[model samples]
Target chain A: MSNEITTRMGDGERVLFSAEEIREDIRVGTAQAAERAGIPALSAEEQEKLFDIIADPSRIVSVQPGEEVIVSDDGCSMSFYGGQDGGGVGAPLSRMQAVLTYERACGADTTSLGHSDYSFKPVKPIINFEANDYYNTSMVTTAPFFYGAQPNLGLYFQPDGPCPNAAELMPMGKIDAARQAQEEAAGHLTRDLVFVGSRLADVGLEGLNLDTSGSAGDADFLAALNAVARLKEKVPDLPILMGASGEFIIGMHGEVEYDGQRLAGLYPQDQVKVIETAGADIAGVAINTTTTESLPWNLSRSVTFMKAASEASNIPVHANVGMGVCGIPMMEQPPIDSVTRVSKALVQIGKADGL
Target chain B: MNKEIFESAADAILRGDPEKAAEVARKGLGEGIDPLTLISDGFVPGINKVGDMFECGQLFLPELVKAANAMQRATDIVNAAIPEGEGQTRGRIIIGTVEGDVHDIGKTIVVSLMKANGFEVMDLGRDVSTDRFVEAAEQFNADIIGTSALLTTTMEGQRRLEYKLKETGLKKRFKTMVGGAPITQRWAKRIGADAFAENASEAVKQAKALLET
Candidate 1:
C-alpha cells in the first residue's frame, strides 16, 4: 500500500503527507495539548488508531457500521433565515416545516426549532404567550422519535437591546462605564435566558442549545453560566447543550470572573468544566480553525483539544465541526474529505459523544 | 511639544489604557501641544507598534482591540480640539457586516484598525442592508466602502451591495471591498469588488491602497 495520505490545508488546498509524518504530528500534538491543559492524554493505542483513521486512503471516511454516535446541529434553517430579500432563493420552508424536514428527510436525531432572531436578547420580546404557539405547533408536527429543541444564542452585550452602551462607553475613555455596561448587559441576558428557557421547557421542548456562548467575552460567558444554573433549578430534567464561539474566550471585559475562575483565555478543557458546573448536560466544544495551517495540522490540533476536553468534562462532549472550525476549512461548502476524517477522529480518538 | 508628555501618551496606548490615553491627550493639549501633533507624534506611533506586534503574533485579538480602544480615545480628544475645517484624516471609509449576518467582530476589528490608521470610518454595524451601505457611503462621502459576510448564505448581500452601487450609477465613484471567513480574492473579483482582505491589518493596507488608486 502507498504510504502517502491525501489531505487538505486550512484554505482547502489539496496536499499530500506521509503516514509516518501525520502520525508523529498527531502523537506529539495530542500529548502537548493534554499536558498544557493538565488533562489526561489519549493512550498510545488511541493515538495509533487516530493516525490510522486519518491516513485512510479514501477521500472520505466514516465509522464502521455500528460505531455511529449521536449527532446534533446548531443554527439550522440558515437559508430560511437569510430569506429571499437576503439572497435566499426558491420558496423557503417555514420554521415548523424545516424542523420536520430535518427529522424525516435529513435523519437528524434531534432538531432545533429557532426563530430568525436566534438570540435570547431579541427573542425575549416575542417570548410572551405568543412564542409558545410556535413551539407548541412544532411539537405537534415533528415525529416522536426526533427530539424537539429550541436554541438561545448567547451573544455579547452590545449590538442588542436592554444593555447599556458599552461600545460608546469604551471609546470615551470611560473604562468604568464600559465595565458597568457589560455587567448590566450580562444581568439582562441572564434574566432573559431564564425567562425564555423556562418558557420553552414549559412547552415540552426536549432540548435547549445555548449556542455560541461567550461570543462577547468573559461577561457574555458569565451570563450563560448564570442562566444555565437558573434554568436547571427550574427544569431539572431538560437537556441543555452549551456550545462555545471559539477555542479561547476573548477577554473583552478583561477582569470578568466566573465561579472563582477567571473567564478570559479559558480553553476547551477548562471551559468545559465551567459548563458542567453551571449544570449543562452537554458541553459542545469548538476549536477555531487556523486558515493558514494544513488539514493535518488543524485536525491534529482540534483532536488534541477535543480529547482533552472530553477527558476533562463529566458531561457528554460534542465537537463543533463546520466551516472555519474543528479542522473544517473556511469555505462555503467544506469538502467531505476533511469533514469525515475530522468527525471520525473526534469520535474514535477524541472520544466525543456527539458532533 | 513636551517630549515627556508624548511618551506618556504613547505609553498609555501601549498599555491599552483608554482613560490614561485620554487624560494624556487632554494634558498635552493644555500644555500647548498642537492637537494634530499630539496624535501624529504621540498616539499614532503607539498604535502602529501594537499593529506590528499583532501581525507578528506577539499579541492576540483582545490586546489589539483594547489598544485600538485606547488609541481611539486619545484620537477623539485630539480631534475635538482641532478646528472643524482643519481636522484632516487620511481618507473616509464606510464599513459594515452585510445584511442577514450578525457577525461583526471581524468588521469591528477592521473598523478599529482603519480608525487607528487615520481613516475617518463610519461603522454601520452588523446586519446592514444594501441600501444603507450606499446611503451611508454617499452621506459620509466615503472614499471606500467595505463589507464583511461571515456566512455563505449572507455573502450574496455583498453582491447585492455591488449591484446596488452599479444600479445607482455610483459604482465608479467609490471603491468597494469585501471580507470575512468565507471571503477570498477570487470571490471579491467575482463580486466586482476592488479589494479583499484576510484580516484587520490587511484591511487597513487594502483601504489605503484603494484610496491612493
Candidate 2:
C-alpha cells in the first residue's frame, strides 16, 4: 500500500503530490526558499500549526444554520507561501469546486450559496468574459441542488481610472461589463443575485488613502455605487450585493475628518445612508482580512463594523469570510480557530440570526 | 515668497494635476522663490493632506496615485534646481512585490507613503524574483530592502530572499522589512526580519525606525 496525496482544482486542474515531493518540501522547506527569495518565513511552530489545522476538519468552527457564508475563489492563500502553485495539500481547488465544498460543509443549499470571483488583473474584456463563463458554468453545476437557494454571483473590481482610449479593455468600464455578464448568465441561472466589491490590489476602500486632489476617494465610492445602480437598472429586480470593506464602511466610527474639516461620519446611520443611496439590495461586509490575517491593523474591529452595518442597512447585511486565505493558520492558533472566529462573528457580532 | 505660489503648488497637487503642479513649480522658480521651500511649503503639505484624508477613508487609490504623481512632478522640477547632494532625502530604499504575487495595490501605497515621508524608493513592481532584489539593492546601495507579499504562497519569495541574503553574507549589510495582508509581526520576527508593518503608514514608521537604528 502506498500513501498518496491528490487534490483537484478548477474545472480541470489536477495536482498530484508524491510522497517524495512532500518529503523534499519538508527537507528543503519554505523557510530556506523564502530566505533565498527575500520573503518572510513562518517559524517552525507556525509551519506545524498550518498543517495541523488543514489536516483536521474537526478543528474548523462550524457555521450555524441560516447564517450567510460567502466563499471566495481567491488563490491568495492556496499558494501557502510557495508550496508550489496550487500543488500543496493546502492548495485551493478551483473556484467552483471550492465554493461547492464550502457550501456542503456549512450545510447551505446550493441555491442559497454566495459565489465570489477575483479578477486578479481586471482587464475589461477578459474579466467580463470570465465572469460570464463563471456564471453560466455555475448555473449548470448548481441547478440540481439549487432549490430554495438565493444564488449569487459577484465580481471584485475597481473602476478603471480615466482612460483616453474609450475602447481600451480596462476596469473603468466594469459596469458595462456587469450588464453583459448578467445577460450572459440570463437563461442560465435562475433566482440569482449579483455582488460587486473593491478590486484594488491591497486593501479595500478603507486602506485607500484619500486623494486630496479632487476627492478621488469619494469619486471611486460614488462610481461604485452608481455602477451598482446601473447594473440594477439593467438587470431589473436582480438583487445587488454591495461589498463594503469593514474598515471603511463600518470601521469609521464617530466623526471622521481630515485636517479638522467635517467628512463622512463613521456612524452606522451614516454608512447606511451611502448604501441606500447606492440602491443596493444587500450589504456584504468583508471579514476576509480580519478573520484570516489582520493586514489593515484594525481588522479586529470587523465584527463591530458588521454589527454597525447590519443595524443601519434596511436591506439584508451579511459578512463574508475567506476560509482558505485566512484559515491557513500562520500564528500559534489552529486553522479551525480562524473558522470558529468567523462563524462566531457572523452569528454573534454580525447579528446574522437565523432567517 | 508670494505665499500664493506655495498655495498654488499645494492646490495643484491636491487637484492631482501633475502638469499644473509642474507649472506651479516653474512659476515659483521664475519668481526667484526657493525651490526646496516650494516643495516644503507646497507639494509636501498637499500630498501629506491627501495621505491624511486617505487614511481616514476620505480618499481612494486613483486619487492618491494622482496626487502622488502630481507631487512627483513638482518635486522633479524643484530637485533639478538644487545642486547635487542638496536634495534632502531620508535614505534610498528598494521595494517590490514578491514573486508569484501580482497584487501591488499595497506596494504602490507603500511607495507613495515612503516618498511622502522623505525616502528615495526604487519600486521594482510586482512578481519580482529574489535575485532581482539583491541585485537592485547592491546596484543602488539602498539602505533598506522592503518586500511585500499579498499572497501567502508568494510570501516564500520573501523568505527565499532572506536566505539568499544570508547565504551571500549581505544580511547584515541591509535591513529587511516584510508586509502584506497575510504577514504579521510574529511572522516577521520568526523570519528574522528587521521590521513588520501592517499598512503603508506603519511601513514608513518602521522603515524610518529601522534606518535610525
* Chain A TM-scores in order: 0.86, 0.45
Instruction: Give the per-residue lDDT digits (tens) of candidate 1, residues A57-100.
Output: 88789988877888875645444444532233334676666666
Question: For each prediction, how big is the interface RMSD?
Answer: 4.9, 11.1
Off by over 4 Å in 1: A1-6, A9-55, A64-67, A73-109, A121-160, A168-174, A290-294, B1-12, B17-66, B69-92, B99-103, B126-143, B163-175, B205-213
lDDT of 2 by residue, A165-211 (tens): 11111112233443333333321221112222222111111111110
Per-residue accuracy of model 1 over B1-213 as CA lDDT, tens digit each = 488988998889888898999999999999999998888888878887877655533454456667877887888888899998898556889989899887765676677677667787888888899999999999999989999998777899999998998899999998999998778776788889999887778888888788878
lDDT of each: 0.76, 0.50
Quick one: how many clashes does candidate 1 have? 0
C-alpha positional error of residue A113 in candidate 1 after TM-score superposition, expressed in Å:
3.3
Give the alpha carbon lDDT tens digit for every residue of B130-213 in model 2. 999999999999999999996667787889988999999999999999987667676677788899887776787788789878
TM-scores for candidates 1 onward, in order: 0.74, 0.56
Off by over 4 Å in 2: A1-106, A109-117, A120-227, A249-279, A287-300, A323-342, A353-355, B1-50, B60-89
Report how far residue B36 has shifted in candidate 2, in Å.
Answer: 12
